[model samples]
Target: WVINIVRFYKVYCDVEPKRQALSKANADLAVAQDKLVNIKAKIAHLNENLVKLTAKFETATSDKLKCQQAAEATASTISLANRLVGGLVSENVRWAEAVRDFKQQKSALCGDVLLITAFVSYLGYFTKKYRQDL
Candidate 1:
């Protein structure tokens, strides 16, 4: 009976360690399963955000292309306007100089006409001897 008791005690000691190891393995497996569930949920959320961002990026790229085209057209128009205005400015300066010359010539012509008219009228009325005496 004592030998039988010793044998039973030895078997109990070995079985106890195996049971504890199995319990620990089961707990670790449960924790790992929970973490896996959380990771899958996070991946799903990230994929949705990526889809939305991709759509927004495509819209922004199209808008950028349109804006660049508009800018180029505006720049060309501004260049044309500058060239036209430059030519007109030079023409305006030349026109102003011509007008000033015309004004001066008109004033000189008026004085010349008055002098000729006076000489003709006085010379015709007086004789050669009276003109020489005066």
Candidate 2:
């Protein structure tokens, strides 16, 4: 009985239209499977690219942070240098004033010395005349 059923099914499936339809369906399934495999490979490649891009982004972020820190340090150094320059200018101004004061004092001292020398000369001449008279 099973043999008879198998023969009937085989004959029905062996018709030209049925055989062509089955063959076309099998080909379509094979193409679909191949497309699935290619899609999966593309997905894997895209995942690897994502990982690489993530690493590059992280490195770029770290480098940017370092640059910011360097900029801050440079700013502080510039501020300190400016302060030092201001201090030097102040000291130079004080030194200049002191020099002017010293010159003024020296001139006054020279005038006083000239006056004392003239008075001593006059006294010396008057005593010499008195001794001659005696």
Pick out the ten consecutive residues of candidate 1 with the lowest summed lDDT.
125-134
Q: Report clashes for each candidate as comma-separated counts.
A: 0, 0
**Pairs with steric clashes in candidate 1:** none
Global Cα lDDT for candidate 1: 0.93
Cα lDDT tens digits for candidate 2, 63-89: 999999999999999999999999999
Model 1 lDDT per residue over 1-134, tens place: 99999998999898989989999989999999999999999999999999999999999999999999999999999999999999999999999999999998897998888998988788878998887876
Which structure among the candidates has the greatest lDDT? 1
Clash count (model 2, backbone only)? 0
CA RMSD, predictions in order: 12.7, 10.9
How far in Å is the alpha carbon of 115 misplaced in model 1? Answer: 33
lDDT (C-alpha, whole model) for all candidates: 0.93, 0.91
TM-score each candidate. 0.54, 0.55
